[model samples]
Target chain A: MISLTDFLIVSAVLFCIGLYMIVSKHNAIQILIGIELMLNAAILNLVAFGKYDRFNNGGQMFALFAIVLAAATTAVALAIILNVYKQYKTIDPGKIDKLKD
Target chain B: MNLAQMLFYVMSFIALASAVFVAATKNLVRSIFMFFITLFALAGLYVLALADFVAVTQIVIYVGGILVLILFAFMLSGRETLNAMALQQKQFISIGKLPAFLLAALFLIVLLNMIIKVDANNLEWVKKSIESKNDIPVNAAMTEDIGVGLMTRYLLPFEAISILLMLALVGAAHLSRKGRGA
Candidate 1:
């Protein structure tokens, strides 16, 4: 039977996979996908913990806020990435090195 | 296992698989589509976990609002052929492979160890808490409670978020206009 521990384990694995993607990929949009994965991992943990929080549903509420914030952040980040593409003509973040010191 | 347990496992598997796909896919459009699928599956899991309101909000805000914005950004960002043709290559740069692998492995080990250390004895306490809280059970029908809570205790934050959203909308429009040289 699946338990909280199983959920936590899966979330942890997902987080690691996301981190790996963020570290390895140079594409801006691909990096955004990785960030989304990491956010989803945290949301899963919040909901799993909410299962035990029978009083106030605090964890579930937090998950809702998290989902909204993730979407908002992604929208803004995409806008920035689009602008970056306009200036650089490419989405490879490694090659968009105009600001690097 | 019962039907609920079976469904939980199915939904969880779908969520995890989609999450992995979101990370692993190379195409930007495909990755965003996978992200939508992942969010949808997570909403289903939220419903299963007895958070119906949260599930509905997830659908409306994420699927309806944000995904549209992302697609718009993708379309409006100019010279699509250039981005489409540029191929990304994997290069091991300054960040060494050994350190990255070691850090991720260490994070996994620590998280698993913590989960394993959770006392089984606490299971009975949790069950008892669930049982005794039946009088004030926060079930699917707690929509009224949520409304009341939002209006009363969370009024400031709710208003603040609305302001933030308005600012974001204005800022996005301004930035996009600047991009168009208007």
Candidate 2:
């Protein structure tokens, strides 16, 4: 039986990596990938907690909803990124700073 | 280590390594492939945790649907000028890179500490049988429970999510039209 600590540790690492990507990457698409990673980490945690909660399976339920939302979010974000690319001719978030001072 | 623990470690390593590649790799196409591996490995871990239905959903939605969509967008964006510009030429020398690295490190540390420090024995959600025996209820009825829950108590959110999905797809189509290019 794998311990819950193992799951938690993996998720924490995933979350941190996602944070790093979001912060350091200049590409808007890459940042969206980071967001997906972070969402996966959260879903992993939910399933881990669902192990003991046999009565309701609330964790699994939330994970389902989260998965659907993540899919929809990726679709919309990629469309937005495509639009951004059209406007700037570049996907680099740093170079497309219209509101920056 | 037993088979289960060994599997867990292997999957975890694949996920983290692929994620690092996704974040750090210069080639965007390579990053997307690596991201596919990361998501695939994560789904394997979900299976290990016995969230079987969620595991299948992960594979179907994330791997099959989203990754494919993202790849199609990449193919569409593959023009000469855009292709030349798409390389992640910006290294870790960006102004905020150091702060972001520090913040990620801090977040990992805090979460790991919390996970390690928590008394699993005293937690309310940690049922007595689970703590005493650590016996994961590896049963077939798990999917049945999920189905019933979705149709019964979770019917509202289920319908809402379907509606949200349709709207998002329509909005995405509208946003990515060819004439809107400026």
Candidate 3:
């Protein structure tokens, strides 16, 4: 049988990778992808822990809700990214320095 | 190792590797592809974990809905791939580079250490996990359990999420719409 440690380790690796992307990548879309990775890591944790709670299944329910929320968030975020690209003519977050005093 | 353990490791490696590539790759379109790989691998992991509903949902919603929408946004943005990859490796090789790597490494080490140091068998839940009674159901219906729970216990959150999704759609339409105002 697969252990919860396996799941946790995977999530940890994914979360760190997502953090690296968020910190290193300048592209707005890449940053959004990083955010999704981080969110998926958390959702993975929820489902992993929920493996034991069959009577309640709260964790699985939370994961379901999280997946829905993630989709909604990505839609709004991508739309904002598109608007940024429209205004700045570039999707590089480093170059879009309008608010950076 | 058993077949389930083997499958878990394989899927996890695929998910982690592709996730790293999604962040590391310079080609934006390639990153999207890598992201797809990562999500698909994660879905596989979810299945191995016996989260069948969540696994299928991840594939349908993430790979189908969000990914298509993301591709559409990229197309609408009208960025040529050549110009997109024009941003050099300077940012990656800069002063903040090594520290970021060290930080991520440290975090991974800390988390792994914590997980290893803790005795899983001692936990209240882990004790029961051995019985396999409360574990994922092979015969039980997830649809009924989840549906009934959502209606009776999680109804408020369900309704709230519907409202949230509606608001998000409206906001996305407004934000992406052209020539509204400054």
Q: On residues B1-182, what C-alpha lDDT tens digit does candidate 3 reach at each position? A: 88888888888888887887787776777889888999999999888767888899999999999988988888765655336546544344464666667788898899889878874436777677648687776455676788899998999999999999999999998998877672
Residue B28 of model 1, lDDT score: 64
Clashes within 3 Å, all models in order: 0, 0, 0
Worst 10 residues of 3 chain B by lDDT: B81-90
Please compute the TM-score of chain B alone for each predicted structure, in the order given. Answer: 0.79, 0.85, 0.86
Those runs of model 2 whose alpha carbons end farther than 4 Å from true positions after fitting are A99-101, B81-84, B87-96, B129-136, B180-182
- Over 4 Å off in model 1, which ranges? B79-85, B89-106, B119-128, B131-139, B179-182
Q: Report how closely model 1 matches the true complex, as a DockQ value.
A: 0.47
Local distance difference test scores for all models: 0.70, 0.85, 0.82
iRMS of each prediction in angstroms?
Answer: 3.2, 2.2, 2.0
Worst 10 residues of 2 chain B by lDDT: B84-93
Best by TM-score: 3
- Cα deviation in Å at residue B78, candidate 1? 3.7
Each candidate structure's TM-score, on Cα atoms with residue i matched to residue i, is: 0.82, 0.91, 0.91
